[model samples]
Target chain A: MIRLDGVGQVFDGREGQVTALEEIDLHVRPGEFVTLIGRSGCGKSTLLRLIAGLLPPTYGEVRVADEPVTRPRRDVSFMFQRPALLPWRSVLSNVMLPVEIEGDKGRAAYRDRAHELLELVGLKGFEGRLPHELSGGMQQRVSLCRSLIRDPQVMLMDEPFSALDALTRTELSGELQRIKMELSTTIVFVTHSIEEAVVLADRVVVLTPRPGRVREVVDIDIPRPRSLGRNAHLTEVAEISGLLHGLLAEKEARPVDEVRP
Target chain B: MTDTKRSWLTTSPVAAVLLPVVGLIGAIALWWLATVVFGIDSYLLPGPQDVVSTFLDQPAYLLKETGTSMIETVEGFLLAIVLGVPIAVLIVRSVILERLVYPLLLMVNAIPKIAIAPLLVVWMGFGQWPKVVMVLLVCFFPIVISTAQGMKSTPVELVELLRSLNASRIQEFFKLRLRYAMPQIFTGLKVAISLAVIGSVIAEFVGATQGLGYVIQQSGASADTSLAFAAITLLSIMSIVLFYGLVLLEHLLLPWAQETR
Candidate 1:
């Protein structure tokens, strides 16, 4: 449902121009889950931002549902690593914000859907609580509810679970898989974790840092409801991890370019 | 952590009550001791007891003057809140608006509002309108600065998340930026409330025949030292009450903010 044709992002820095992404080409089919994996500053997040139209590409084009994305479209939703919950709003209100912002004055219109999203994220009983009152995991769950509340066709996530502890991360990874199955929305998620990418994505696009370009796209042939336990798919996860590890080593070995001159 | 301790202190009403009551008592004792030991002249500094007596003697008049001063303070403070938030939002929305308007705001704020008090009196005449306008001038800066800073400080992650959701600029402002800025806005409001009261009194002192500032002026002319002290005491009370009213309103409107960093 989304296509990036030679998408490149160049940022003007105090030292000079800095390229974040270069000639990147990507396509995400409807109901597909794709994860872009890379080390910090690999432009994975930049690619996601470009797809979400938060930032326009310096060159080439991004298209969603065959429409050139000049700006953010109503059918796309983005999730961040942090919960990004508004501290002043209750969980339910935060989830309902998109609807309210769309000037849907009728609370009755989206209330049932919002409630269902919250329940899907396992935040049913805590809708009235403030973001600050919840644990980090719970806050992120509230944010998930918010992102899904509008029932968008596309979901772009930038390391949405990277900040959580190992246990919560695993728990959320499972919940996310369940959510994906239920929602059936196209997703482009960015992550630095190979294990997470392997478990959650149908295809993992690995990139190198600084003028990031796709190094490889690894397909995960493992079945759904996957876990990081002693299972047959564990070998597949290990293989992907090894591939990611080699790319990271190569990324580190590349001599740092001095852009001052 | 300091935050934990603060939440603990505030969460328990008994502790909250004790801290302030103890602080007030300590301040009063210091004042009483300084007056008695130094043998300060009543003309220079009336004792707290004498000021209280003066207030009691003219309770009806003092109350009426207090009401007049309060009306002007409230009017100006409310006007500033209404105008300042939108102006701040506009500045945040556009670089051109910020560059064009920010320096002018600083210039207006820098021109000692007390100096404008007389001009306001000359233009508006020796009435409540001049006092209200003067209060607005003094209070406007804090509201504008805080609101602008708050809007500017909307978490980058949060902004990215909203953009990913295909939220419009207006949606981002109302749902995310505005809500996020509430705590900082209240911080400004708390400061502006006191300033508003002070501004009204200053304007009245410059020109007027009623209210606490006029009472101070009239007492000054007649060399009624005790009455001047009484007026000053009433002004102090007014300032405290106005500030606390804002604090109370903030607590009511944003209970969640109390726990935030």
Candidate 2:
């Protein structure tokens, strides 16, 4: 569904040019859930922006379903770490935002769908309440409902659960998995948590620190509707976790620009 | 009863009335004591009783002038809100426009509004229009500044989240940015209301034949200190009333914010 060909991002800092990512090539299939895992400043977010078409890549091409992405695609949606609910709007209104903006012709058309999305996200009675009135977890849920309102083909989530508490994060992770199953939409999730990557993604693509490049892609043999606590895939999870730990430690030992060739 | 107690403490009705009432009583007591201890001339510092008597004696005149002043204040204030909010949004949306126009706005704001009163009178003539323009000038900057700041200060995470959802720029502005800016916009409105009164007074001081400012100026010339004080007191009353009106609106429109605050 999405492909990045030799994509690179460079920042023209006050000091000098800083490369965030270099020679990044990847292909994401339809209905695939891919999580990008790396240390802070590994350009995971930069890569997500490239896919979202929010920023132009300084090098190479980013394409969605064979079309070059020059700008944000209508069929792709992005989610962020923060809930980012509008404090002044009710939950229902927030969810209805994309429809309203797209001029979806009639309000009645989107109303039922919005309600269903809210119900799916477990925010039923909260339709009348404003964002600030809800708890942080609940606010994030509203954001999730909002993102899913458009039913985009691909969902790009950048550390969507990182700011949430452990319990809420766990809950949302499970919910996301369920959502993936129901919708079967392609998703590219970015996170720092190894457990989060393992629990939520089919393939965890690990990258090295700044001037980020793919170190490895670890496939999770975990079955659907997976839980963090207990699963038949716990042993596989541990093995992947151990592998990621080794990569991280090795990367930390070397200077950022020094490759392990 | 404990639940009621909790509700009492948590709600705005009790705190709003109690705090302000206490403050007013304290202020009145100080004023009365100061007059008594200093044996201040009633002409220089009329007691609350004297000011009340002035109001009682010329109720019709005070009411008429107050009504005129309020018309000018409110008309100008509403215009400022309409004009300021859009300009603020534009400034936030376009960096080039913001850089070009914001400093100009700041320059206009920095000029003591009192100085511009004469210029406005000269341009608009010694009529109600000048006073209205004056009020607009004084009240406009804070509204624009607060609104622009409010709009710009939208949480980065929320913005990123919206972008990830493939929300168009216009969608992000109206759905997320505007809603987020509302509480701060109300802050601007409250500030503008008080300044509106001041602006009207300044215009009256410069050139006006009606309104509370005119009443105060005319009373000053006649050396009727009590009447001038009466006009001043009425001005204060108008200011307080307008301010609370905005507060009431914030309560109605943004109950969520009020609850959180």
Candidate 3:
């Protein structure tokens, strides 16, 4: 589990001091799929960085599993918008990177796990291929396998599938939901797509633009294998998407800080 | 049949190699025609046939000089790679070091290498040391710059991923940054090898008892134009061989780097 208490971040810019996030509070339960949705510069990514302990909050505290996070934790993994595979490494080598960095003592133990994860992501024979040999979607899948190879307690995904094509994005979203069920890991995924937030998250946390604040947390009461157009709860998916859209529209009228301060 | 058809296209490996070879032969043919038609003296621009015959006239002596020059080139180039990569690591790892040392590197790189050749001879004497040092000087800058740029160009997402794993500073560098920078380092090495060949030639021009450059100079004084042209031709062959040797090494070491794009 991850917890943020009154977390705020202010960055010094060339022009002046700039507020990226303010008076934030968030909690992600174990094995929960939570997605943060907002427009660019909403500080959604900044918040994710704080949770992953990649950056410290300027104000307040972030705790993971009841421990105050002063720095990154070995049990947390982060995925990026880009696959970020090393061009000189094959897929298997790229997936084995963390193990290599940590030490080779458990290399044999984790090699099988890496291969299984690769297979789970539909990249079985691709272990020998380079990142460039694959399409964009496939590259992202390799990254997914890489993140899962560590078998971490939490996964922080920052728009992991946004760079993919629309059809691939939809397909990956379904696959991600399945991966979450199989992996049973806590996840805090970030995206700008309302539909993506609706389809993938158990709870969608929407944030207001610049100097981001949690505008609303909409719960999706849909079963697994959810989709934008083909789910058993298709009507519910549409309703939740509509609700998220309205919340974003409401943000245009009222500044979150002004309303809640 | 399809392979044959495709091999004739612009992007085929066969065409890729053959086109350049054809162009080079055409250029030599044009030069030979110009000399014969204009009735130019062999003392000016000797014919290609005249140059080739000069190489045949004293193969042992000319080959020995070439071998000597080549040894210096390789020594200096290898030294630059060994020293320059670590310097790049230091600059990338420590901000204080980068701020302190980067400007000095730039200043040294900015000075014309030809200007340094005489100073090197004064300092290191007329042996192979001066030439080796000169090669190091010329090749060192591009190696450091390219390596540093490659290390710095790592995606923010990958850095965060490594951070989330709570990797040590050393691990972050050796595993992630260094691997990511390799394709680029080979790029630097390729560039530096060519410059390495040029550097030895400059050092020889300043003062040398033997080398392709010395042979060329000696021939120029004696008005043996064919031998001078022959020496120049040998220099070009040396540079071409060294450059391609590096390209081949890159292919072997980082097959994945080439596979992507």
Best by lDDT: 3
Query: What docking class should model 2 receive?
Result: medium
Which 10 successive residues of model 3 chain B have the least lDDT summed? Answer: B1-10
Best candidate, DockQ: 3
| Candidate 2: tens digits of C-alpha lDDT, residues B192-215 | 999999999888887788889898
Interface RMSD of 2: 2.4
On a 0 to 100 scale, what is the lDDT of residue B65 in model 2? Answer: 92
Better of 1 and 3 by DockQ: 3
Docking class of 3: medium
Candidate 1, B1-261: lDDT as tens digits:
555455666679898889999999898788878889999987788778878888899899999998898898999999999999999989988999999999999999999878888888789898789988888899999999999998888788877767766677777777788988999999999989988888998899898978888998999998888899888878888889888888999989988888986
lDDT of 3 by residue, A25-142 (tens): 8888899899999889999999999988889899999999999988877788889999988777789999988777777777898999999889888999989987888999999998
lDDT of 3 by residue, B22-130 (tens): 9999999999999999999989989999999989999999999999999999999999989999999889889999999999999999999999888888898889999
For every prediction, compared with the true complex, DockQ reads 0.59, 0.51, 0.66
Highest TM-score: give the candidate number.
3
Question: Which regions of candidate 1 are displaced past 4 Å?
Answer: A103-109, A229-232, A251-261, B1-49
**Which pairs of residues have clashing backbones in candidate 3?**
A132-B260
* Winner on DockQ (1 vs 2): 1
Model 2 / residue A119 / CA error / Å: 2.5
lDDT value for model 3: 0.88
- What lDDT score belongs to each candidate, Candidate 1 first? 0.85, 0.85, 0.88
Pick by TM-score: 1 or 3, better one: 3
